[model samples]
Target: MRHLRSLTRTLHKQRIEGVTFHFDPHHQHELSTAVRHFFTTPEQHTPLDTPEATRGVFLLEGERKWVLKHNRLIHWKKQLQNYLGLKKAFGLHDLTNEFINLSAVSAKSACAPSVAAFGYKGRFPFLKEEYLLVGFLDDHCSVDDRLIAHPEQASTLLPQVFDLFARMLDEGFVHMDPHPKNILIAPDGQLRLIDFECCAHSVIDHDFSLGFLMGYFFHYWIKRFIAMDDYRTCCENYLKVEQPTLDRSIFMPVFERFLTGKVSRTTRYAILTSPKAQAAFKAQ
Candidate 1:
């Protein structure tokens, strides 16, 4: 059976070159203990990225560039464990395919290399997933770093980012992680979107086009975070430019029309089941 095969793979920790794989459900605890010891006194220092709600990402480089994602200290073995734990989880759209799939969907979509996934060895408890043999980005700094250094540039860059957002929504994918840090611009000045760990598909009408999505996102981003020096005046201008006498609730019909026509079954199922979506939809 597939479960038996998974178990067998779990028992034997396989390593190819510098990459180590841990998918064992049984030996997770033992493997975690050993890994912690090894990592604590690593032959090469392991750099820690910022902490996230779900996991801690680490930067590793020796033979190659890699981003290692360690457990969040509490959870089931895999990253998808939380999503799978929720009701109608199986019916939810699979974001695991999004990283690779984005390339085909859009030329602007860029992502960090995903070389491997690890869990645990033998019958231990605790899961660790390591990404190995990744290719480096041209300019390694994240958008957050860039913005922190050049706040004035926010006006220019944020617009381009909103464009990216619109395109993804029009294309029927909702990039759940839109933080500035997740986007990277190559040396060639081409934009790339990275980190698909929380990506999901949404219902968007085919006719909606990337432009609509981008414009909306740009406004939303500006409203939520970015505050240009002229922000107060600009916001007043925006209100005047796009004046709407109708109540906000009137937009629900418009949103549903697009969602029902454009979104896939998988996305629809996820939207219906997810608590996040439930609240948003209810409010709408």
Candidate 2:
């Protein structure tokens, strides 16, 4: 549960030169050695194949497993999205989006994997990259794909997915890029989220959170993972859990946009930019 607690609580945040480091107060001795091993022996790390738009390495030392989520140092070239005023919408903020989202979630929550440490400057030597440390899991895979292959599993897992989305709506944060790949299925059937870059989505208008949910559930045109009817049923289930008083008519526009955009090149854009999705955000 230490990993699930407030990241700023036990970790001592320090800055050396231009790099940042977080030392675990509870495991100072163990963290010191593990951090060094992860940074210095990058070659021994095995790369995890992420279908989501993310890249990271899995490091093993003795019996511990750690996953280091990484991103290259930013340059003026990386600022083009900012110039276009699409930074937050695209989750390109300097603060790692995953950390931002995870920090807002309750420690006992099952929505995401607990992040261990933040701002680890990797030893690329020739180039620099920032990493977020996450405790490596034992056995897990994409929950979305697993359901498609084993429809029977959906009987129990589908409701859990809907419940998670409803809770997120009530909580106010939204995961911008809604890809099934971001959700993982544990051996016991619990779900966990990973690859947090897209958590920084939507600025003033919070309605897009619903769009995120729609895309997350249906994946719309990209993979056509879930049918429109299935998504509608999901919406109904969501309304019951998050807003039982609201009628289905409330989501018509979002549904219409998704259906129309499915054929158009702008389906993704349409879903994220719509004005009636209604979920507010608590992440700062």
Q: Could you say which candidate leads in TM-score?
A: 2
Once model 2 is optimally superposed onto the true structure by TM-score, how far is the C-alpha of residue 241 displaced, in angstroms?
8.2
Residues 96-147, model 1: lDDT tens digits: 2332233234333334343233432222232223232223454566666777
Candidate 1 accuracy as TM-score: 0.53
Predicted structure 2, TM vs. truth = 0.67
Off by over 4 Å in 2: 1-10, 13-19, 50-55, 60-63, 77-90, 93-95, 106-108, 120-128, 148-156, 200-212, 220-243, 259-284
> How many backbone collisions does model 1 have?
17
Cα displacement (angstroms), candidate 1, residue 153, comes to: 0.8
Once fitted onto the true fold, the runs of candidate 1 whose alpha carbons sit more than 4 angstroms away are 1-43, 46-48, 51-55, 72-134, 170-172, 202-225, 228-283
Q: How many residue pairs clash per model?
A: 17, 1
Per-candidate TM-scores read 0.53, 0.67
The weakest ten consecutive residues by lDDT in model 2 span: 275-284
